[model samples]
Target: MASAVFVLAPLPLGSVDLAWVCIWTAVLSASLLTARVDHGCKADLWFMVPILAAIAAIAVIVWIQVAPNILANLQDPAWGNARDLAGIDVPGRISLTRSSPLLSFGYYLVFVLGLSRAYLLGIDGWQAHKLLKLVAYASVCYALYGILSQLLLPDTLLWRQKEFYLEYATGTFVNRNTAATFWGSGGLILLIMMVRSILHKSDDADSARVRFLDRPATQAVGCGICLVAVGMTGSRAGILITVLSMVCAIVLYLAPLNRGGWLLWTSVRNSLVAGIIVLALVGSLAMGRISQIGLVDGQRYEVYKTVLDMIRGHTVLGFGAGNFDAAFPPFRPASLGSQGIWDRVHSTPLELVLDLGLPAATAVFAVAVFFFASLITAALRRKRDRHIPVIAAGAFFLGSLHSFVDFSLQIPGFGLLFACVLGCGLAQSISTSTRGLARRAPDWDSPILR
Candidate 1:
């Protein structure tokens, strides 16, 4: 879990990319070792089988169609490497070694499943609690960094080239919004943990590690700190999504489904109270930003509108994946010529449509639907803490909602984090498998058992 947190935690420079490679290498090596140590363990086999099959199928399909162009991109100059395939220019062809169909599918496949594994281990395995702690610690560190960064060096310093992005607070992230997104998601999860701990006071020893959550004042304080961080980032989309996620969590956990019970009314009343509290805090801390967010008649709103136009133009296949960086200009207003150098679509669904076409988009949506349904069903069945799934569900919804305006999830780090949380929720929805540490252990920590 420490290793996982280190791998995913935000870094100040391009070092995060290096961390990604290192973490993946460690994960793969550990998996191999664990299989040898726990010979009878079928955890990896069961979890990986479907993921491998999907990768295999996608690889075959992409190879036949996209191999040549991808290979060409590899050899081409960095600036000119990007091309319009199926209307989208695959992103990062020049910077990355492989761009062919097979590699692309393989990359995304691993990316998705790696997270699924994390989620599975975190939610169902004994490591779930540990993983949550790791996440919280990492988040608190990140929040502290943001606050300090603002205080010590409010302006970008000469040594800090990366600190120029003032629109959002990056903390340890490459982008401010990305940092806030992480913090926001972590905030929601923390809220759930704190609330759950409160509801289970007698299980004090077991919940001691997460005991800080039991205090209402502490929860409120934590929420306040996180909300302020969210506001400082100037991420209206993120702020909205975070609030929505909180609401959804409440609805999923507190709302009653039974025929006759005060649960429904209680849930409603609680929701109203939570909503008021969140609103009051956010309104106080972020009143200025909130006003600006509501009045979105400037460049940002125009960018969103233009993206809508582009999506309409290429509705069926959309621009090819990564093509928006090159394809955005033709759709932009002439006055913003130099301003719109074409970097991103600023929208995830639109990006998807442009990347693989309508069919691919549909396929992605289908997968999301399946995961969501399964999560909701599982959460509802948990006669105990319904809020757990509610929190997960809210984060999922919020992240998806956020993708509409910002491409935060497109960043590999952010994307991986999103996948990890979603996968964890999905895994939780399924069988609640519990394993003795001896029987089920990741490879890296296997030696510790001895």
Candidate 2:
């Protein structure tokens, strides 16, 4: 339910309060239920500790900045400017905007709750698989609607008038890039399931080719729809990043097929070749659109340059959490002649550095890298239930790369969903303990075996 709420919300902004309430409610309810049934709410989701700790550290920093006169040195010049303009002493704090940091903290908590709930649920393979299936189906619904709505009501989204990107399919999101990421995410999961179906159905890869072509092609249809929607989004980086991640996931997931006790890299190569062939057919539109736009947006590149310049000055303490709107204006150069308010800097890590300082942002970034490595390692090591880890690993690639050029993962809905998926995969990847180490071995001396 938490995972459902994390992704199903129509708009990340308008629905955030409700999403927070719903997801946290689901988490608490699940915990209580587990305590009642299992006598405890124990979960081996230790892998999430690094990221969770990073969030907590950032939250603490925000709290400090929000605390009046606690660290007089950390207060921003904006607070002093307010006092000078009013000719009175105002509260000294680091954050230029109080509500923004508080709101950021709220979103962080919601994400953590979503991840925690998913980790617990994913411990049970049956339940975890069911949850993933539900998510995949829901994603297809999103893609289907996104594509249909583009055709029937290009200038509309849900009950509202869509003022921008009318030519593209954005589904519930306002930004085409975010929508692309969402669609691409769903597409990756479908691709995984489809590939898994092929691997699980037959032992001989060569023999399975004909059988695969003959089997029902339902998953392929879903993948195609998702690809089409992503293509229609017209986000070049989004399309390329997603497709590359899918191919990598395919290659890695099928890397070491142990047939007759002989490990073969042939299947890995074959998977890559097959992926290219299938994508050429299924993702033609998305692939075609990749060459439609130049690799970089000039305006966005300038923004990145300016943001990097800003980060150098305030590398220690940031402008404050969620106060990018407040911090960006003074730093905005006249050369970039855009009259629009530049709140988010298009790049999540750069924006994060501006909001949470270098250390905090680096901590967050490092955690992602850690997950990428851990999930891949686990995917290779684990025999059964490796698909879940594979999906999570691919998602790390998709989310991290998109984050460099877009802010999709920062959206409360997408962020929470990503967190949930990562948590679930990490939970499944770790080996479950079969027995307590403290428990004495079954009385071998007691002659039951004899």
Q: Which one is best on TM-score?
A: 2
54-125 per-residue lDDT for model 1 (tens digits): 455445444433333444423224324345434446543322223433333433654555564565465443
Error of 1 at 275 (Å): 2.8
**C-alpha RMSD of each candidate structure in angstroms:** 7.6, 6.8
What local lDDT does model 2 show for residue 250? 77
How far is 27's C-alpha from truth in model 2 (Å)? 6.2
lDDT of 2 at 347: 90
Model 1 residue 262 CA deviation in Å = 5.0
Q: List the residue pairs that clash in candidate 2.
A: none
Winner by lDDT: 2
> What lDDT does the true structure give each of the candidates?
0.56, 0.71
